[model samples]
Target: MDNTANPAFDVTKRLRATSPKSVAIHEEAARVMAAEIVGTVEIACPVYIESASGSRLTDVDGKEYIDLTMGFGPHVLGHRPASVEKALAEQITRGWHWGIHNPLQHRLGELLLEAAPCGEQVVFCNTGTEATMYAIRAARAFTGKSVVAVFDGSYHGVHDYALLVAERSSDRRNPAPRRRGAGIPSEILETVAMLPYNDEAAFDIIRENRDRLAAVLVEPVQSSNPRTDIGPWLRELAKVCREAGVLLIVDEVITGFRLAYGGGQEYFDVDADLATYGKALGGGLPIGAVAGRTDVMSVFNTGSERARPIFSGGTFSGNPLTMAAGIAALTEMRDTPDLYPRLNGLGDRLAEAINRHARQHKMPVTMMNAGSMFHLRFAEGQIRSSRDITSRYVKAEHVFYQHLQECGVLVPGIHLAFVSAAHSEADIDAVAAAVTASLDTLRNDGMI
Candidate 1:
């Protein structure tokens, strides 16, 4: 294979020259930063973003690309949306943080309860990791059990308990927790019981572990394995958790406002005992929350001697800025009831176009989606679980991502793409075309 003819390889060379500033910044970051990037180890390239607006990101090199990652599934309204910006601007005049009772938090909480099917009352936090962490703690306090059940390949957050159980796959009916990385204790890993995703047989595993389990934590639609037809399985899972007397904790960090105004619970036609939310809830700001039935959620209420409260407070939990931005975003979503369907239609169009292009080129890659969220896999056949995503495809997928970057499309390191309300039909079509071109380049270089 001629390396010079490789489009992604050529992109690397061109970017080295065009992105001198970003390259220097990355070199400086690498000196002090533990990892090459700030967030995850899934660093695609050293491209540094200077500004973002609508569906486009401008790199430090001044090259603009159509972004589909959407801030890793939070920019439902797209980057720097006008509504969110306006709210933030107004809030700038008020205050940044108040270590006291803020009225905006109460109003936002009311909006969440009104929209969310599972939300009766809510507790605020900074991120999804905090939300899920507190949700599990609340469940343990309520049920007086120690064990928590989570499915394989479902990412809850960066917390220790949620870490080991996510982003891995096994065929076992009852898989043991696999540590995500070093530093998390074996004792914390043991507290989590793993189940197979999208498999009906998981009900049996739940039945066996019901006595020791305090709650079953799950993502209604696994972001790692994006799919739209898992409603039946999720409904069944909810029923099993209910019958087993285990609290059902739905982690909607990725799917919350992105799926619908009401989120996963509404979209799946099932109710959870407790639901954790983040991502788009604060528009582009950082925020998270745990919402659920009043009875089950009352474990956090510490008013009397009889009340046993779980400590879930944060200094920045209910900051007024996040609340204002959240209200603006949710109000816009509520007013425009068609936003979810419209964005979903665009996503479906993009997925269909990519699949059609792949078939035309005889590429084996499979593109799967759930509403605005999508993933590309190098495997053949249906991918029901994260285990089904073959390791053989990892290199090809990484190359494909680089090729897409070369073609002026940005997807996250997790290989997940998101379509936002800002993405027009023209943008989707252009992305599909870019995919075809990128694959053609890959085929020419014998990379596919």
Candidate 2:
């Protein structure tokens, strides 16, 4: 094989000259920062972004690229949307942070409750991690149960209980829980159960563990394995949870607002006892919340005697800046009836075009999407669940994304991409073209 044909080698050479500023910045940081920070696949190019606006990003080196990550699911309205920006600017003048009560929280909470099917009340927090942690705590306190069940391939947050993966050697239908990373105690394994995604066998597990289970947390669309045909499965899961007397906590961190105004609850037509939200909720700002039935959420209320009050507070939980942004974003989305339809249509068209191209050329790649959320899979077959994925084309997959970057398109390290309302038809066209060119380049180089 010719060395020049390797995309990684070519990418390195091109970036070194065109992105000298970014390379220098990365070098400086590498000397002081932890090795793990600078070595992630997400930052593969060391291309530091200088500014972003409306589906495009400019790097410090003055090169521009179309951004598909969309702030990893937060910037659904695109970066620096006028309404959110205006709200933030005005909020800054009034003092962005105050440790006291502010009327902004009331309006934001009202908007959330109105949109979320299960949301009667909301509790604010700093990030999705905190929101899930608090939701789990409340579920346990409310039910007096010791266990929380999570599905395989579902990512909730960085908390100890949320960082579980199914043991690879265990049975696919009945998998054992394993810690994803270090620092998580082995004892946490006892408090959590891992279930297969998109499988009816999970229903049996829920029933068997009903006595000890407090809540069954799930992501409507798994980030690692996105699919559009999971509505039936989700609806059935909700029914099972109800039958077993276990609370269902849908982790809408990635799907909230992006799928629809009501998030996964409306998209999948399922109700939850408790639902956690983040990502798009704050209009590109850092925020998280748990919204649920009044009875279950009342566990946070000290005045309620139904259950012991669970401690939930944060210094910046309901900061005025985030509240202003959330209200502005939600208000625009609610008023604009056609926004979701247009966004979802764009997603459908993009997926169709790329998948058609792959089929016509016999490429072993598939673009799976759920509304605007997308994931590029290396295999070309029906993917019912994350366990069906194979790592045979891992090297080619990395090279394909590198080639995409060379063509002025950007996707995150995990290959989970999203489209926003700000992405025009022309923008989608360009993305489709870039994907085709990348696949062709990979084929020519004998990488795919």
Pairs in clash, predicted candidate 1: none
In candidate 2, what are the lDDT values of residues 20-65, reduced to their tens digit?
A: 8988888898798776442334535677789999999998988899
Using TM-score as the measure, which candidate wins? 2
Q: How much is 22 displaced in model 1, in angstroms?
A: 1.2
lDDT for model 1: 0.85
Q: How close to the true structure is residue 120 of candidate 2, measured as C-alpha lDDT?
A: 92
Output the number of the lDDT-best candidate.
Answer: 2
Q: Write down the RMSD of candidate 1 (Cα, Å).
A: 2.0
Regions of candidate 1 where Cα sits further than 4 Å from its true position: 1-8, 36-44, 165-170, 304-307
